[model samples]
Target chain A: MATSIRGRGGIGPALPLLTPAYLWLVVAIFLPLSAMALFSFMTELPMSGRDWSLTLEHYAAFFSSGLYVTLLWASIRLGLEVTLWCAIIGFPAAYVLARVLKGRAREAIFLLVILPFWSNGLVRIFSWAMVLREGGLLDTTLNAILPFRIDIDLMYSYPAVIIGLVHSYVPYMVLTCYLTLQAIDNALIEAARSLGASRLQTLRRVVLPLAMPGLLAGSVLIFVPVVGSFMEPRILGGRTGTFYGTVIEDQFVAVFNWPLGAALSFILLAVVLVILSLSAPILRRVQ
Target chain B: MTNLLGKLAAQAVLLSVCTVSVHAAELHVLNWKGYGADEPWAVEAFEKATGHKVVNDFFNSEQEMLTKLRTNPGLYDVVMINAAFTGQALAESLIQPIDTAKIPNYADISGEKANSPMLNQDGKVYGVPWVWGLTAIAVNDKSFETSPTSISVMWDEAHKGRVVIRDDAVEAIQFGAIASGQNINDIKDMDAVKEKLTSLMPQIRTFWSSENDWNQMVASNQIDIGTYWSGSADRAKTQFNLPVSLVIPEEGAVAWLDAFSIPVGSDNVEGAEAFINYMIDPEFYVEWVTKVGAPVSANEKAVAALPEDAFNRAVMGDPKVADRIQFQAPITDEQRKEYLAIWQELKVGAQ
Candidate 1:
């Protein structure tokens, strides 16, 4: 009756607890992806929904088709710009949250930071369009008094999409970076200050290096989704230079080629994985 | 022998009468939002007309409607798709051959310049004609001191950055094509199209993607001149106190017709045909066309019913204006590909 396996060496309790997460991950994530991978390999009817023999032509078309290449590259470039801008803006904001404000004030400011993101992405983009368009708020009210135009042509350019994307995802960056910067000991900053370092030097020498983990974390979180976004570019960037996400959407909806859509999705998944792989070592170094 | 033959003939007549008395059927219908938004009314109409219960749903776009049809043959009885989808839909055999004889009201169909298949290649009458429209250039008369007659002013370089057009691929491309004096349909030389489009891209303040986008652009005066559809301008002029005009350009416009077609699906073929016939009725066609801010095409009676102002503004049977307007056409897959490719180069060059 005495199953006294509470002994440390038995190792039986840990396996079962860990097994469920692995099982859950496989069932929820990997299994559906496996089915999609199977479908993507099969040939699709030109416009007759889905039918025919299995083939690799869709994959070939994705790479060999020049349109796909331009779009994919444009999306990558847009994500990089958003990520870079988010880091620049978010890091300082995050550092301030960690270092300057406290208690209700900090929480209130944090809520304000994320409150705008709670509304729909589509609505926010439209409002931004209202500001950015000519004779718009930025132009009529702001640029009228300025030396130059607000560059109305830029509303549908890569820059507009980037600005919209950066605005949308900056909160994610701030929160992640704030969490990391918070984990850094205030004692270290005090020590740096005690050693006769200025506030700027304390930030650079003590706070910045310690906060790298959160910065990298924020970058991955923002960049991956940014790369996948179609609506931002389609609405703000005018659908002329479609991102990778829009291409996948078109294959399924507009073109009625589900297989090609699936293949493109998997390629994007591969790209995400490669990015993760490349970033992991640098992330580890940050840690 | 005469008595026996008389009894057999009487029995046959009785059998035919029995079969006609009790049959029940349902029809599947697809349309845009707010169109079949009044489904109960349509259901009542269907019951009154054909003694069949109508099951109707709304599809946002032609592609979704056709996708549903392709996946499930004999599942949907009827669909209302836009004009731009018809060419490819016809070529792909996604649309069925309709028995035009059943739709007695087909002869009354107007907007012949836009909706009628006689104007296009492979002109098999698949889609029964529905509403062809006047969702065209709307101007704020206050914004323009003089009455304007051209779509060119929407892209004038002097107006420079104040210009606007829709963010849609085909519509915006058409605006550029019109500006460049290029054929909207046959734009194979992409370099020329790109160069032309790139020129316009700078002039445009916004390439509006949705109905809301165009409305906001005009209402706020974010854009002074733009190519916009009518339903939106009608709302702004009537409701928002925004003084805007929906113009017919001197050069003409590319217009559309949303029509009813039975996609390759449907269990109730007979019922679908009856439903299409029901929509074409003068009473049903008139309310829908006017309510949805569209101009009616199917009924002579409906055009006659419109108030004097709406009629004079071309909702009435104006053959001359209809003849002159350039109708929207469905591009081939090859053409669609080419158009988008050039559009990309245009965006990059604009930057």
Candidate 2:
């Protein structure tokens, strides 16, 4: 359809069709981002007749404070950990769904894989709280079945935060990997195995390399949001929940420092762009 | 055809009578969810009596409330603001001075609360005192051999890894200030406050930001003792049946009052005042306190009317405890940043 349209009007005819999407991007993405950038340099929000002036102090504050840098590092580490766990847990599930499962069973299991997305995020986080808290379902069930009592309290800890995030994001990894894994020709795997290659070797040499794009896509999908996540950490990590995202949230909501919040957010955006650019080479090579 | 015309005439007459009797105006109220203003029965009663429908919008934080007031001028007729923020609202002219004459129940409000400087600017009232409560310690009865009386119990080595506090910078700083015997409104030494809070790092199991979080931690037996709101403690005990006890420490507790204010560009001032009046009415207060847990009503008459066994009365009745209450004062923007900086540092240090 695009070629036919271009054959008639040399792209001018498509401008009307494309304008809406581009306009939407400019309005929804660029406009608010530009506004945030402008606010980041402001002394205060120019509203309600409050005195305001342009200033670099918010960015200066971010640079001067070691605490923000440390928290940003912590957040990055959290993102990496959560992404790694998601890949580890999700890849096997995706493999089963794509290679092992067949017919109605695959569809049903796929439905179940995406089931967490159907429920409210807060409700899901709270449900995890019930299961992870001390003397909670996990603890009582373990103690009830085991010969000896063992405590299994994991709530409000770093592990709990990781578990919650991994639970929330693992589906993205599964969905992405399943799509790519399904597209790979099974004949290649069979041929590798029919030759001298063993099953592990077939998987590592044939299947894994084929699935790299999906894995990278899944990693990017999971990593970006986890780094900025506040609710999961606040609800699950508790005392250890404070992160770069939560601090920025505090500046806006608790501290009423929007200029600083904007600055922090803009910095996070820059960091994410840098990381994405750094990873682009690897993604291109894998593809 | 004759019967249809007769029915249409009858319907028209009824509609006219209804319109004449009811002067209904929708009042948009801003408050914390589940707080007094949004009580279903009370709103129903107010609507029935005054023929004005109440629509409630909630904010999770005081800053969000201020933002709503600032951004959406003429949208909200009535807003519930903490007294500490009332001065800021007045300064920004986000809220207009409430005429006490419009709310007859204003006379029944306790003079101390009504005359609080936080609600007044240039001798004009910007907010009408509504409800008040404390940020103090709550103890799990099962974990304690005896009641703990001092705020220092938070730092007690025995309860290490089982204590929690709200995850708010200002509240945490004020808590530290109180523990260090510095006035909440005026802390001279920042380092001392930082030291006191840093010392508390070992004792904290987690930090709770909401009533639900606090209740869940206590219910699951995750926390033994922590800083909690007085009103929430009442709910945990009476409603949820959690074995929690509220303790006012010897070092005193932080108190905050929520007040009803008219936004500057309110389209329905009469309706707003009527809603505020109904909120402070003794009858409404009695039902709200009995059916649902709440901060103590600012109206002395409402407090007096509570049953002797009412949870609020049992917890807040003592005049001696009142003497030790340190009402939260207005904090400057700079002060908030400093407190948040110290708090962020402390949280980072904990990790």
Return the interface RMSD of the candidates, in order shown, one decimal each.
4.0, 1.0
lDDT of 1 by residue, B309-339 (tens): 7742453246666654666777665555445
List candidate 1 stretches off by more than 4 Å: A1-74, A130-160, A237-253, A257-287, B1-28, B35-56, B72-75, B83-104, B110-125, B134-136, B172-192, B230-242, B263-274, B289-292, B308-317, B328-330
Candidates' C-alpha lDDT: 0.70, 0.91
Q: Which portions of model 2 show Cα errors greater than 4 Å?
A: A1-9, B1-24, B309-311
* Tens-place lDDT digits, model 1, residues A40-85: 8887554454247889987997777576777677778878889999
Highest-scoring model, lDDT: 2
Note the residue pairs that clash in candidate 2: none
Instruction: Kindly give the stretch of ten consecutive residues in candidate 2 chain B with the minimal lDDT sum.
Output: B17-26
Error of 2 at A150 (Å): 1.4
* lDDT by residue for model 2 (B184-246), tens: 999998789999999999899998888888887778777889999988888788678898999
TM-score of structure candidate 2? 0.94
Cα misplacement distance, residue A256 of candidate 1 (Å)? 3.6
